[model samples]
Target: MSFKALIVDKDDEGKTSAGVQTIDESRLPEGDVTVAVEYSTVNYKDGLCLGSGGGLVKTYPHVPGIDFAGTVEASDDPRYTPGDKVVLTGWRVGEIWWGGYAQKARVKADWLVPLPDGLTTRDAMAVGTAGFTAMLAVMALEDHGLKPGDGPVLVTGAAGGVGSVATAILAHLGHEVAAVTGRPETADYLTGLGASRIVAREEINETVKRPLEAETWAGCVDAVGGAMLARVLGQMKYGASVAAVGLAGGAGLPATVVPFLLRGVNLLGIDSVMRPHDDRLRAWGRIARDLPMDKLADMIQPATLADLPELGRAILKGGVRGRVVVDVNA
Candidate 1:
């Protein structure tokens, strides 16, 4: 069967090019289940894989979508059968294996999760990998003893996909949310997502030469790392923890150990790719119950396969303001 896909291929001069292409089902990689992709999503990783950045994709002519949701078209594995609604995120499928920026996908049955109730395939993709990661971060923060009564939780890069969802979820959990963003225009957007306060990016992106700073945040869900992480670490409340989820700012951690040693602050590293199955299920279940779907619909921006190239570049530039749910069939 012929299908349309967003295929990225680089040239000999290291110039990268990407666009939609027509390919055959026979070209799909070996897997136990095949899905007719209704929706995929754009994340920072997908942006990188679609372009020449991210350092995640090591191959050429790749399909760069880290999250997808649809119905199984066929399955050789007993775990799934044709017409089962399913979703996938992480497990490095979009990076190392062929992924879901297309009309169809064949992936290991182990990577598939039956779509949680109260979520359509489009809704699932709207949450996508970024939203899933945000959920994981929220869970990690709570597991670290954070509560809504624990003072204001900070969400860095609040306008971005992961940060936006984190802000909404934290606020939904009854936490006072402080959304940090460079763009002043997103204040209303963040507030609509339940943020009680909006913090300017310049306030927190300072060089962390100080081992400690005046404590401002009770806890943090950080999507921007590098100096932001270092700066936020110093500003966290004593005995507070930060869930470090992304490196949109930068990867280098120019941090001191004073927060850990003196303040008892915790920096929890979060990885969504290799998450254990049970944890994934629990997170999805919680998301279905806790995430405000009405608010989520307000934040979703739809795209098609043809929009991937521009969307990829926009995400890298930090221009994307909300979750982008790509309709592969569109």
Candidate 2:
């Protein structure tokens, strides 16, 4: 059988090009299972893979989707069968391997994790990789002894997927939430998601001349790095931790490490890719239970495969808000 797929390729001159085209099952790579994919999503990474400067896809003719949820159609592994539901987030699937921007995908048995009990395939894709990373950030804070009573938790890039979900999850858990964003229009959106305070982007991006500021936040989930990360480091409460996730701002940390040394602050780096299978499952399980579904309705905006190219540009420019759930078969 044949199906519609999005494939990017490079020609003889090494020029990159992408399009939606028809492909046969024979084009699929080696795997233990073949899935009838129902949903995938657009992440910052997906935007990178689709964009001209996005470094995610080094090889041509690639299908760039980092997150997917579906049912198995064929399997060589005994643990899986045609009826089981599964989801994929990392293992560098979309970057190093062919991913879920197609009707069907064949992947290693080891790369698959059973969908969490409370989430449907659609719901799973709604959370996607970004939400999973947010959950890990929240879990990291929890693991480091952060609690609601300790102090307010700040979520930078609060309008983005990871930040929005992180804010909601922390607020749902009864913690005070301070959401920071550059767009003033998104203040209500962030407030609606349970943020108790709305902070300006400029307040978090200014140059840090001092080693430490007033003990501002107890913990933080920062998706925007660069100057934003550097500023947040100084604002944290004594011995508090910050989970550094995305690099939407920039890759460089241009500030001193005086906050870390002076206050006993910890900077927890979150890398969802190459994470142990057990940890991924646990994170997904927590997301299914903790993240508010009704709130996700506002955070989630659905798109088709055809919308990916435009979204890729929007996300890179920091224009996108919340999760972009791609209905792959739509």
Which candidate tops lDDT? 1
Model 2, span 1-330: residue lDDT tens: 998777877779767666788899998989999999999988878777876536667777788788889999999999899999999999888887889888899899999999989899999988888889999999999999898789899999999999999989999999999999999999999999999999999877876688678999999999989988988898899989999998888899988879988998999999999889989989988988999988989888888888888888788777789988888788
> Model 1 over residues 1-330: C-alpha lDDT tens digits?
899999988899988899999999898889999999999989888888988846788888788788899999999999898889999999998898889899999999989888988889998988988889899999999998998798999999889888989998999999999999999998999999999999999988977568898988889999989998999999899999999998878889999899999999999999999898888899899889889988897689999999999999998888788899898987
Q: State the local distance difference test value for candidate 1.
A: 0.90
TM-score of every prediction relative to native: 0.97, 0.97
The candidate 2 region of ten consecutive residues with least summed lDDT is 51-60
> Residue 244 deviation, candidate 1, in Å?
0.1
Over 4 Å off in model 1, which ranges? Answer: none
